[model samples]
Target: MTPETGRQLRFAVLDMQVIDPPTGGSRQRLLGLFGQLGSATAYVGTWDWRGQSERKQMLTATLQEHLVPLTPAHFDAVEREAAHINGGTVIDVTFHRLAALSPGYVAAARAAAEVADVVIFSHPWCWPLVAPVMRPDQLLVYDAHNVEGLLRLGLLDDGARGTALARDVVRLELELCRAADLILACSAEDVDGFIRLYGIDGTKIRIVPNGAFAAALSPAAAKEREEVRGRLGLDASPLAFFIGSDYGPNGDAARFIADRLAPALPDTRFVIAGAVGQSLAGRALAANVRVTGAIEESAKADWLRAADIAVNPMFAGSGTNVKMLDYFAAGLPVVTTPTGARGLGGAAGAMRIADAPSFGEAVRSLVADAPLRLDMAAAARRAVERQFGWDRISPATGRLLASRAARRGPAPFFSVVVPTYCRPAHLDRLVAHLEQQRCRDFEVLVVDQSPEAWCGAAWKHGFPLRYVRTDTRSAVIARNLGADLAAGAVIAFTDDDCEPHPGWLEAARPAFDEPGVVGLEGLILSDKVGDPEWRSVTNDGFEGIGFMTANLFVQANAFHRLGGFDGDFEEPHFREDTDLGWRLQAIGKVNFSREAWVFHPPHRRTEERESLQARSRFFEKDALLLRKHPGRYPALFRAEAQWTHNPYFREHLLRGAARYGVTVPDELLDLIQ
Candidate 1:
């Protein structure tokens, strides 16, 4: 089903707090995304007085909010668990306690997940609680605000306790990544971190930057800005301001402003707002620095307008700074460190980037020169509109929702069938690779055709491995036998030599959502093929409907309808995959996915001579294929020719090479012609 043919998707977001006032960047991002979806609901855990009031006023045209009251007992339980986990060291236990203590939150989230086509969890902590309640068909997305493990590790003072907690956090994060169908990272760096730290496939992750809504800067807000400034009783004195919720990084930034920047810029009055303001109030301030303890959401715009310059002296933080985006929305010139301006990328050019020593000077310079400040303010506003505004960011979320909504029916569970003959070592590697797959629903069926049952060693790798021995020395017969014994809705095929990517199953699972799609061919990347032409062929084949069993997924019923692979081709062990592809095409539509990739190395030492001899027998198999399906071979050959010249094929080859960290010669393209 196309997105236009389907009903509007109902989005449910599971978060730790009510998003009416949006406490931090994560909540703000969720609110912005939810607003764009139109039919959206939020299942939030409200633990405090602030959240309770926000929950009461949460009903709106675009969003329906469900609040789960988290009592003091919940906090106590979480603290106890954290203390036990960390050997009695009191660490940040909010996330750790969330899944264990908040039964009401979990129950509410589960209810939301049942009806919604798409369910988004705000953090990894919510995954364990919500995952069990989610239906198999629901598209689970993780809106990762930061690499929480790394963030927590950075905040810890006790090394041993920190390491222990970090390890636990990393494990939980990995589990969450494995559970999620798609992970929405706050920045590109977080995406890279997931891949680098946990070996998660990049295809499953996407960058959805944190941004302020464009409505914050709309014409109507200008009147409110002036009223707020007047209400605050701000004079002509050039006011510099900073605002943040009570996070470790925010506290450090506040301290930096109080101790370093405030003392240097004595002539300018600096206002510190939000939750962090209370912490800074006790600190010795330069008479010029004023702490407005926890400014209300209504007064935030006025505070921003009252300030001549906005400052973010953040030395530490993992994700994009939402406060910087807010400052830009308020049309205030920003002076932030490179660290503070991390995910802004090109937008950072609009702000004054400075280090610790030079931060105060940059702010003072902006304050002293009205012309420079005006130029920067204009640039900042333009940057926000161009990049850091919800108008630009929310559309990506909309597109993702629409695409997922287009898929019909419950998600099919896969039974991955690997037909191995005599190559025990290859089977071992294949099992190891399968164990790393992010999608955990699938089970492995290793159809071993070896004389001896050598694939038994793979059982220790775990994840529901079924090893069956077939006396027949045929890949075709092995696959059919495996399919007969398989219990999943879909049967995915891969040779023993092929190493499937971590996200291969997750990426391929979506294709079967379309009832018409009977088959899916995943990209086969090989560095072993010495010929540039063959490599081009590998890339080209990725787009073609013609399937290769090296990496293929087909509906179980469709496989049965096709009568499985022809047992006649068992001797040669060639063209059986192609024959099945033709049979599947005759029955229903076949889809291709480049993201579901597998690396197929060239023939090993023992098989090289056999493979060489098999090349000579290809014509016999080709003849049989042509005779079986009369007049189709010519069209198939023509389609192959078209695939060879496809622009995407060349791009795919280059991208594949880059992914493997291999450099292909430029002359290879010249040879393609």
Candidate 2:
């Protein structure tokens, strides 16, 4: 866990403001990651001055808390002036300055990266100025928060210079990606966009979603709302609040609610909050429309807690809506435009949706029906608690980054087919190991015959896995069932009881690359074998045949060509795979790879060994396969009567063998005749 120890990942977020720090969803996520990887050094680059006021209040306070004071020097004088004005102020002063002064920022971050193992330059909007100065390393990560500047420069509007710049920015970011060891994005949408835009491999990108902040979650004082409501003299009215005012979309939302909706519902008062443009704030306000004009930070949560409904009439924006997430955490029902709820994915069930035309009606309906409003309120709270909260998000984020992120190559994207019956313990281990794999372009198909357990943990691991249920049991049939749902280009087979080597794919992937190789065999390295007498005693006891589908890989298209497993081979037991291997060999090659190995857990007892199918059904199925594919095993079916007195089987096998295209071997046939 030491910074200089094994595989250190240094994060250099240059030009990422430290003052108000934007206090947006992205900041919350960065803080969460910092908490998770406490070992990594975070180099935060900022403008010389944040702001006169925010510097005094937030920046100074935070710096004073973390850094010790010293006597003034020449550089200290500059630092004092810069610190006084370099924070979260609304004016473009800090950002413009930060954009202009990135030389110092680059120097600081690069210095930090020298001693560190990884270098990450992020905040696409801010660090373009510093991109030229960054040093290349084995682990460089670029975080693309948004493609905003392109949209604003009118270049993205048409085939102008901005379009060229947008194209260049995308090209540059891609170049940066190829130069780095890994890349991170806040959403899967961003990750996918970068892949398409930059032509980087999809495996290189990892998604770490923006997290919620504590300010949104801490309960507000009930009396704070009472004071604000009393000041507006609307104590009798039900409150509904809106945040974000300076942004054009925020202003439009304010007007939409005040002009279109406030007249319809006099009993409900709409409070337009946050720092507003002077002109927009003074625009035609109704008696029930209260412009709170950016409530004090301390009172923001109180206002959210007081509101019966929160409205977000956003017309444009990308990325998850931080305000909506904050509202949901406060347990308040919301009426939001489609654009406002974009990317959260769970907002449809959590909020009331309304466009500009229906906006007024939607707000009034919720105001009139208290029960409907309260139900939505409860749903929103549950959505936040279950899916959107930081605690829930952090764990999933950690699993993906630590277990599956930063892997790319010519690795075979294979689907693993695992069939299980009452093997919950084995199923859990298989999934956990799959999740931990350094190479993850694979799907796990689990066929479960355990009606009692319902594949409890296997389905809950949050990976690319599928589960199917069946009552009748046959290992071959179960495997065939799993193949039906698999989506990967190549199929890898492993039994529920086997533990694949970490490099199993690294070793076996080449077989698929081999021309005309259809079915490849994987060795089952078992330390313990069932008793030989017992293996012999069980009818069709190829359970010890030891070739596991559990460790085999096949081309999906080729597996489909073999018509899946021969279901007619019902032994509650054997010959299904041997029959399958030979038939596939008839079409192509079946090469064995000693390199591909899996450890089959020690065998269990006879009582545990028996599958639940009745003996009568087992005998019928064994008879059916022997009849259908007699050409593959001619001697066993034809001479059954001469050597052993199984009259029913001999009669069926001879009639069935002739019915099919199988010819008895001449050497054995002469003796039998």
Candidate No. with top TM-score: 1
lDDT of model 1, residue 493: 94
Tens digits of per-residue lDDT, candidate 2, 135-189, equal 5433556655543332233224346533444555555555566766556665444
User: Who wins the lDDT comparison?
Assistant: 1
TM-score of each: 0.57, 0.55
Candidate 1 per-residue lDDT, tens place, 1-673, comes to: 2355456677777766667667677678767766665555555555443234324335456567667776556666666756654644232334544445556656776777788878887777667666667778778888888887677677663667556666777777888888887777766567667777877755456566788876765322556656766788866677888999877789899899888877887888888898887667656788888888787765777787677888899988787889888888878878888788766643532577778987877787778878767666776776667556776566546655555555454443998999888888888788889989999888777888788988365547647676777555667757866775555678899989888999999999888888799889889887645543233125444365457888888887667544467543444456678888888887688888889999887544345443433344343344445545655654554555533534444444443333222334444446444
* lDDT score of residue 80 within candidate 2: 43
Query: Candidate 1 versus the native: TM-score?
Result: 0.57
lDDT assessment of candidate 1: 0.69
Instruction: Name every residue pair that clashes in candidate 1.
Output: none
Mark the 10 consecutive residues where model 2 has the least summed lDDT.
61-70
Q: What is the lDDT of residue 536 in candidate 2?
A: 17
lDDT of each: 0.69, 0.55
lDDT of 2 at 529: 47
